[model samples]
Target: MVRRRLVGAVRSVFNDTARGERPVQPSDEALFAPDTPIRLVHADVTAMMVGGVAALLMQALHPRALQGVLDHSNFREDMLGRLRRTARFIAVTTYAHRDEAEAAIARVDAIHARVTGTMPDGSRYAAQEPGTLAWVHIAESWCFMEAHLRYVRPDMSPADQDRYFAQSGLVARKLGADPVPDTRSEALALIARYRPDLRGSPDARETARIVLAGTSRKPAERALHRLLGEAAVDLLPGFARKMLGLRRPLLTSLPTRAATGMLANTMRWAFGR
Candidate 1:
């Protein structure tokens, strides 16, 4: 049930973008800058917002879904291996720009702190409070989803705009909240009511794949791979085909092992495993 809604939300965001509606962030210019670096940054933001919320909701609602997805014997191991590969790829690509990644991480940490009312090294208070956790998760998801629909969608049609808003309202209703407004200022106002701490933070755009992978159950991981493929074709042109084709086999061979390793390492660090 939640999975289907999640998939629907993903499709709606993409479709909203394709229709040129202000579904996510309300500024198309920010999302489609002509410069390659800027474009990459924009893509990163879109992926982060869309994938982050999706991953969080999935984790909160279906904590065991990832295990189910990975139950295909060798499948899980192969995914884990692929992640390690992808991490290496990110390192190679952004090694020279470590500062940028770190800055982004800092921004995310700050936002997380503000929303959860605890610093990185602080106690996991939110984890213990179900109400706080659910509220934060839903708020984050709504913010990210709204940003994507506004800025990233390609077309500017009335139907698309209506659909985008409708979907946003549906999500809000699902969480027992009122719908967000169509304007950026109004949307921010809504976010502020729930996450007053994050009202003024500069928005950061971490890569979707990386952020989602950090969470326990990420519905968008596989979907993101597919999206990346589409993005490579439409935006990068031939990049995905050449690189992903070569990387796929290695990735496929060790999913479970890699995911388990990551999960184990995280647990060990966070809770002595």
Candidate 2:
């Protein structure tokens, strides 16, 4: 009965929005918006959550997944090749902001150096050197979007989303990278240029659809319940309560020590800690 009601509510919300009516404001909206410093912080939090969950799941199921995904033997060479290709794309599109673009490229170089503890083989990595300024302008802009979208309103009108994407592509091209692709792979590839070592087999086009869908329609609370069913609740009652508190905070609280223990228990349940 509860699930049915929740589904009905979600459908009603979407129907209203689709018909140009104002949907009910979620209680959390005031706390989460596109243009706040808190949004950036939230994005960072979400990234950490995604990374941590991925690591935990992979470790539990197959410890070798990491090694297989990041096969070190050809990793550097492959990454350098991709970077060079990306640099060419940036050169043509980001010409107007050449200096800023090159700085973005340098940032990627620095990230590479930190990751590998050595510079990529210059001879192996060499492509026609594009203007440094252009490279920075492109790479940094891409980084900004990657970091920004995770926390900000990932849902915008289709027209606005397209405009924002185009502006990002322009930044990339000005830095000497090729024109950005309208497809999901193109966006993922752009990100890969900076962090080639990170590998996930997520389909770019599917991801784009998910992002758009997530933004376009009202999110179904039933989906949340499905993800956190009775098994999840029984496993860590305290943490489960806190999650519930997110929707009804006035009804839940714990002593500091108990809250700490609940969090620890939740992580342990999640990671076998």
Candidate 3:
């Protein structure tokens, strides 16, 4: 009974019961094959949450992407809601039937079509822009892999890692991301190419704060959220941390990593993974 309740609570956090999202059962016709790296990596709830936060920070560093969020999304007010929607998207795309995954992609594409706006510097920005979408995809895939490696599979093979990128690239292509990276080297090179376009605007920093601070009212939940946020920040590249004016987890790195690993293990156990 206790284990069942714990599982239900975790699922509720990720599944958004109010919106009719439940756990996605992996389908024989899912986008990726069963036991694939993408499936294994994305299965750990704790790692994905940490990685998702890190990815959001990385994505906000791009002025156009930040502008889109500021002008269109209620990220400031409904951060958890936004995160749940993203989690749902990943679950659907990764584990649902191919038709459902394609429909999910179509829904995102339609939303992107409407997410255009002008940046603060009088430049037009569209969420559907292929280059911008590529950055988003790269940041998310890289961070997710980083978190998975750190918390779940430190020795995941190079071939499997490459396969993960290749698998995720299919979704990126469907979403109109140009030049999606299908290997670790390609992802690094793509990030390098976009370095000049990244920035730490005021809006981005504020959003980062909101994301890391989290919205949990319960003290225990808040403490766990802080631990996850710190771990996520520690996973970022030094350049990204510097641009965002976020400090490295220097004195607390060991404890933070240890605590996060424990939490990851506990979550995995709770979910019977």
Candidate-wise lDDT, in order: 0.35, 0.33, 0.91
Clashes of each: 32, 36, 0
Q: Each model's TM-score, in the order given? A: 0.26, 0.25, 0.98
For model 3, the stretches where C-alpha displacement exceeds 4 angstroms are none
Q: In model 1, which runs have C-alpha deviations exceeding 4 angstroms?
A: 1-152, 178-185, 192-195, 199-273
Write down the RMSD of all candidates, one decimal each: 19.9, 19.7, 0.9
Residue 64's lDDT in candidate 3: 87
Q: How accurate locally is residue 87 in candidate 2, as Cα lDDT from 0 to 100? A: 35
- TM-score, candidate number 3: 0.98
Cα lDDT tens digits, model 2, 1-273, are: 654564455335333445464322223323223443322322232222222222222221111222322332232334223323343333322332444445665664544333221122322221212322233333334333432343233453444444445555543453344545443345446434533222233322222122212222235533422222221222222322232221222233233223423433443344322
Which of candidates 1 and 3 is the stronger one according to TM-score?
3
Q: Score candidate 1 by lDDT.
A: 0.35
Best by lDDT: 3
- By lDDT rank, best first, the candidates go 3, 1, 2
